[model samples]
Target chain A: MRKFFPFFAVLIVFSMLLAACGGSAPTEAAPAAGGEEAAPATQSGSTLQTVMDRGKVICGVNKAVPGFGFLQEDGSYAGFDIDFCKALAAAIFGDPEGRVEYRPLTAKERFTALQTGEIDVLIRNTTWTLTRDTELGANFVATTFYDGQGFIVRKDSGITKLEDLDGATICVGAGTTTELNLADVFAARGISYTPLVFEGADEATGAYEEGRCDSYTTDKSGLVARRVVMADPEAHVILDETISKEPLGPVVRHGDDQWFDIVQWTVYATFTAEEFGITSANVDEIKATTENPSIKKLLGLEGDMGQKLGLSNDWAYNIIKYVGNYAEIYDRNLGPDQPTYIPRGLNSLYTDGGLLYAPPVR
Target chain B: MQGTVPESQEKIPFWRNEHTLQWIAQFTVLAGVLFVFWLLYANMQRQLEMLNLPISFKFLQINASFDIGESLIEYSRSDTYLRAYLVGVLNTIRVAVLGIIFATILGVIVGVARLSNNWLVNKLAAGYIEILRNIPLLVLLIFWYTGFFLKLPDVKEAINVGGTYLSRRGIAFPWPLPTETYATYRWVLWLGVALAVALGYALYRQGKKTGRMPLYGLWSLLLFLVVAGIGIVVLQPYVMDYPHLPDKGFNIIGGKTFSPEFMALLSGLVIYTSAFIAEVVRAGIQSVSKGQVEAARALGLNGFQTLRLVVFPQALRVIVPPMTSQYLNLTKNSSLAVAIGYPDIVHVYGTIINQSGRAVEMTMIMMATYLTFSLSTSAFMNWYNQKIKLVER
Candidate 1:
């Protein structure tokens, strides 16, 4: 044993050095995109083909957001984002109830999960930003929702706007645009407020409720979702001010253009279907009798856009038939009548005086 | 089989020779490790190339665009990620140092209590060790911040004593505000302290040479405070500001305050780590022979004198080595501050990793930082161990 001691020690050191070199090569080299995303192509299979072969789409989503992607008590996921995932699954499998495996990810883990090919697409409430697109090695397909950061405080706190938050403590979720935006706006306005940051929305909101912080900051849509769950929703009120623009949408890995195009058009198809007045309930009727060329092409009656995307011509029809159009998705989860009661404001179609404009399907 | 009669005289093949086999085995293992490493490197390179994501540290120069909840140094959103990271390192070191000091004192006290003749004190110390030792550190931190601290009274109804206040928001205490004159008088204060310590050392050395007892420690402390008091009176380096509740009293201002996150993390780490350290101290004290204690008593040394001069000095030999490990554990365990948003190194890195997408680089830096801290702590303890080591006659 004495004779081999030195050899064993050397062996252990060598292994450790080897492991360190392997583990940190990417991390040290790329400080911005945590080493997790540094080697995306290291995985064995093409994500697009892998999903097809497995007969399921592995979608990264948020299970915490109320109107976007919430996990239900029955163990089923229900939200606008879930519907979009189902729509993508239907586009591939030609059935709205097609197999989709939902993976819930936190704000920090979403991009890395996509970069490492752990999920085919991330449809969490992710904002499209220049740095995220270029540096994160992930591609944003299209904007599905236009949001803005807002603050919520108990009515008795008397904080009605950004100015009123001066010298007050603001609670925000860490590793999010809301936190960054709060810093920007507060610093710009010369407000001397302390920020209490938490790792999750629940923690941030909890701190706010406990009076540890005077205000809770998040996207306006999220504030509404969080408010509805409060024991006494009437006591708290969301501020009228919008702090920062947040355009949230689905995201896919950067390398595969084909996969990117597929997800992008899946979002656009919903927009076009909504524009053409095609509902899931009325899609079959429109396909049978539509005379308008764009409507016909969108429903795969007059064009081969689906074929170009490596799918059958009936892909859009399947998405609409199974997951519904944009209107159907919105009205189902976040419409004014829902528990969240979020207005379509900027999310409405361009024809309806909103920011959503779909390029002609033809 | 045919060469059995002359095998001793025959030249052996390299593979059959024991000396050559050992070298061959060593080289083979080394080569295999190298090959596996090479494979991993090649795979990562290929993947990065395909993904069009080149590894570069240039992103550290970019604006951090995020704010830390607390920082020791000046920081703004406009600062680079590197600066933000430095601030994070400072915060981490601050907590680690404070935690180590507090944990050691608490650990030693409870350790002695565990061995006390009094039943209640012994049972209480043992119970503390068992309870803190069993629960997970992360759960403890969560419980401390959310379950306990958050349950404190609202900010408007803060419990105030003198000028300080305690509320769910945080604990506020009086703070000193230094003006322009502080810079000139600070040096005088430092000089006074140094002179006092040097004078104390001289007295200690003189007493050692002669047979006199000077009580150097007590005198030195008094001398230091006297010199500092003179400097304060002459220069007026700073003004003390008392914390108070404003009219609305929503939050405490114009004072030094410990953020709820920082308090929870520090308490959880100090409390949880003290339990393990208490066990080490107990074992160390027990290792001193019973004969030594009885011998000291027979020499007319009282119980306190026997403990301080005989038991503790000898017990330190065994304690220092393990105490080093406990200090390191407390420092490393501080990474759990990220879970509660305490803005420690790990928490800051998590935000940077998400913002900059440099997960690999942040992880490497974090590992290097912890390693440096552990080594530095071990080196200091080892030096102390050498000073107290048994010198053979």
Candidate 2:
């Protein structure tokens, strides 16, 4: 008891300090701006200012899926989603090589990482679903790629179509849209199949290769990428069927409207740049001499749209000059020219008979 | 000790007083811990509110919108996430229970074999323990699932056992089908089990008082079957479906099938855990005194009887405590099912967290589940330990 005197004194002081710090935390976060919206104002402000001050945006992405968010052999990320991360950085810092930190995450860890501020934006090949949109407290910026669930089977397996896959054992990544869609579509078709789920697409592919499953299922885009890595590419084929709509895109946490706007408009700028025939190479020339009001406004030659989103006037110009237009990003990663080619069917510009239509820049 | 404290020697200030300071120290430490916890709670609340993320368990009631590969209970995409979680819990418990039983049997056998007089048997048991103990469990799980299970013949050339089959898909066995009349049959079976238990207890009590060995095991078996036989005759029509080799599909048609994931996970858990349990059992058996065994042998008990009646009872006393921990380990280790997608509780909750983004609430539920499992296992083991403990006058 006599020896405990100093310990008690120290403990009392520690508790006092903890109480003082905890007591003031709530009030400390309360006085940013805007009465009812002050929380979001401070939340969004602090996040945006942090990125600006830190000079790097932490982006969560998938390292496994090729053409969307694959980490290349050169120790650099090279994919469509990687370009989106670069585009966001370019919007903020006016340099495509702006300090962007990439945190490769799995499907299980991605959202929680975003919610915890471990990543500022998630640009993985994530599908926008109702539950994710409404419940996950994450905001989908815009659809970058339109994909759908499809099956890849050995050509000799005689599984030519979805109907032919009845009673088949399919390997899929657990917790993915592919897994859920497979269940929904199979049940709807009144076909029974054994689902062998894996945590990662890599493992599922490994199992598929070993013949643990009759077929491997994932996004058609993913299937293409996975198929290219097969031992014999021509030996397997992706079925010509799309089972579920998978609108893949970039996602940011909710409550940061300003930051969300920065990411959202950054993606939209790519489409608008493409819509106006402005590629990365000619973005500077167009910004300098364009007379078109929409292009001029979009390139930030007119209007304070960037200012409204708490960015510099040349934010759109920076995005185009750095990350290129949407078509360039797509063609570089997933076009017919690439090994993992995916047709730009619904991902093309609206005028090209696709569903990708950006809201008017003005 | 009380008298050593000189009474009324000095009237010290409360802070300087020994007993007062000791109480103060404890209370201060507890308060400090509580304050730290409060700080974390406040910080989480602030972050959640700032992010506009509602913290609620209401999402558990919403439709899962996902399908599990295998379920023991009725489950569909329309079922609530809570139901899905329940299915996962049931699956986990099933595996844990099965793993525990199989591991115990194998552990005891290998443990006994480890000390066998036969040099070959001893070396073989030692080899098994050494090899399995050295490798990481996850590596083994992946190896078995891919190198062995996946390498099995394709479904078209499944290894046939009667009408059942084993292939890369999985193994299927004949299972009794539940029909509309199964409810009545189930009641009859329950009644039979209850009656058998009562009669067995009566026979044991009679034998105990009379100092004669009771054939309680045989009597219980005969009585159970008699009651069940009467019920079956009354019911007249019962149905059982045998698994049939599929003519040309990847799955069996009529009977219950164990998914490859389940088989891999179960085999991985059982084989891995038995190695550690085998060591514990070996130590327990070795801890028994040689004098006691010799005394039993001097009493004209045969070697087997000396082991069964003398050595085993003592060894059990030493074994039960460590065996409780092994049971808990097996239960906790079942979480590795996520790697192979066995749809255990962790895997299911993980999917829920990914889909719904209720990371905080879902994590809390997961922690609570494992905590409950460990606590219940320890509680049961503690009760059994107390019963088996030697009474000292």
Candidate 3:
């Protein structure tokens, strides 16, 4: 027992030393504000380099949202957000088809995936909010789809307006802006309602369809998309009132400005191509014949615009050449002919009285 | 010889000594474990700091900014995350406690029935045990939820029995609501409870000394009820609040409600856990020696008395230790409430983690909460087991 005492003391001392080392190591390695500035020098293009080395861009996306990001029967992803991911892959590898791997993530898992470097970019239909931007250590590169919270109820339920929803049970997807917005708007109106929060949109919509809930609430676009797949789409109607602004977009981890720039410019490249009347079908012709300076620079006919973003000069050209412009991507996934078609109201170009305005490439 | 060390001990070097080597090995393992934990902690801290997300519990003070569907306490979107978390804790306790009680009762009955002389009853109990024990709890929970509860008729076509309403929305039943005079009536009720306990203790002691046991429990219950009856005449404590479905509204108001989520979760947990508990109880009963039952029968005791007074007390000694584990499993399995959208601790923690981005802190709190519940339950069970434990002179 006496001899064991010395070993116990040594063990205690060793553990204490380890604790001390662990406690102080983070302070030395991560100097808070100083770390952010110093991070870029050490890890500016790290994500890009990793993606290039791995030969595929790993994208976290939604498998549930129909028009934005949906998993198809053939195991391929096809949607508006997926197109953005493809556009990003095109910008990086000059090929979009085989250069992207999509990881379908829940709303609760999207931010964590970005922070943990599990995915290079998150293209889920995530709304941009102040708390998420500042607290979640995420950077919202650009708003690809401007949506707003809305409610959908059975047409025969007589719930035509928000006031009719008093004392109603509303089904909402958990851990999304839709849940918070439902609570806020209803509470502000002094409308007492029970929010049946489900972990996924599929469950929430299923609950609503089963009459377990009186109404289902989510983004207007999501409501449109989910409604189309219901047992009887014409039996339900989205309410006219838009409850809260939900600017959905792609997000990346903070402190990686180069990656952020790449994703941001990838989005802008699509918008600019649309503004310049360039489609995948017409991009090659435009690139060969256009003498306009901005078009030339955007199409990689002149200058080093893509090089400034740590890419080959043909990056923007590749994105347009493969994934097409914003208009083409939107029309393909959510066009008027599609079952989940949502009219491009705020998603249209600025010249067409919408909010999608891209800054000049030059 | 008294002062001299053993020859083997003398020849052993300190480095090769068993005691020293064992101590060194233990210390090395301990050091290795500590180093690994420290490495993980340091890595997490560094990553969080680099991402500008410092680990802080201050987020608990922020407004939860979300509404829980059903909470025992008065909660709103304006409440703090701490309050929301407490609501979650209370919900978990409610389900766990109720699940433990119901599961034990059903398990004991089924266990006793499994050994019955009737062929049909024994086979039915066996079938129940086999079927429920085989399926996973989460699948059963989802089946009970989506396939059973959610498939109930809509609010408009709700099945109403007496004053209670059952629908896909939930079950709403009449509950007692306190009137203004309830505060004054509560003291009399407490007095009755105290008097009943005192009388029961006195009767128990008298029975022990006289060598003839009395029905102390039944007498105490009767005494309490007589006192309660007299109190009710003098002061009415509560009025029954009957639920009423308004013609146009979606909800059944004015009474207590068991949300479909809670009902499904409780039923799933009880049914799943009762199967294992029934087997434990059956084994415990079987562990009681046959000689004890024969001896009780020879002493002229009835079949019920022999089983209750001789067999059960002995069986309890065997039943308790394993029974504690079943209780713990049921409590832990209640965390699956998240899958069914019950506002349990894990569900609320998920929301909090999303809203605050404090996954580390919230996870710690959730784990601590579950640990506290499990520890408290096992501690109580351990105490009870000690009290009923066999003693020898």
Q: Which order, best to worst by DockQ?
A: 2, 3, 1
DockQ by candidate, in order: 0.40, 0.60, 0.45
Best candidate per TM-score, number? 3
- What is candidate 1's CA lDDT for residue B387? 98
RMSD of each: 5.3, 3.5, 4.1
Candidate 2 CAPRI level:
medium
Tens-digit lDDT track of model 2 for A1-362: 55766877777787778777666655544566356456655656666887988899999998988888888899899899999999999888988684799999988889889988899999999999887887787889889888888899998888888898887878888778887888888888998877777788888898898787889998889899988888888989889888889999999998778888888898999998899899989987877788999988887888998898888988988888888999999999998899988788888889999998989988
Model 2, B1-393: lDDT tens digits are: 332566667766676666765676677688678878878887787678666676889989998878888899999888999999999999999999999999999999999999999999999999999999999989988877877777788777778888677887788777766667778988999999999999999999999999865768889999999988998778844666887765777666777788788899889989999998899999999999899988999989889878877898889999999999999999999998898879999989988898778888898999999999999999999999999888879
Instruction: Specify the CAPRI tier of model 3.
Output: acceptable
Q: After best superposition, candidate 3 residue B233: deviation in angstroms?
A: 5.2
The residue-level lDDT of candidate 1 at B29 comes to: 76
Provide the clash count, candidate 2.
0
Task: Give the i-RMS of model 2 in Å.
Answer: 2.2
Q: Give each model's clash number.
A: 15, 0, 0
Chain A TM-score values, per prediction? 0.87, 0.93, 0.90
* Candidate 1 segments exceeding 4 Å error: A1-45, A96-98, A285-297, A300-303, B1-13, B179-188, B210-215, B230-236, B248-250
Write one digit per residue (lDDT tens) for candidate 1, span B1-393. Answer: 433547568787776766776787778777867777786767666555656666778889999988887899999889999999998899999999999999999998999999999999999999999999999999999999998878878878888888787888888888889977899888887887898889899999999899564778889889888988888888888898877777763577778988888889999999999999999999999999999999999999888888888899899999999999999989999999978878889888888888887776677788998899899999999999999988879
Which residue pairs come into collision in candidate 2?
none
Q: Per-residue CA lDDT of candidate 3, range B159-254, in tens?
A: 989999999989999998988889988888999999999999999999999988887999999999999889888888889999987887988887
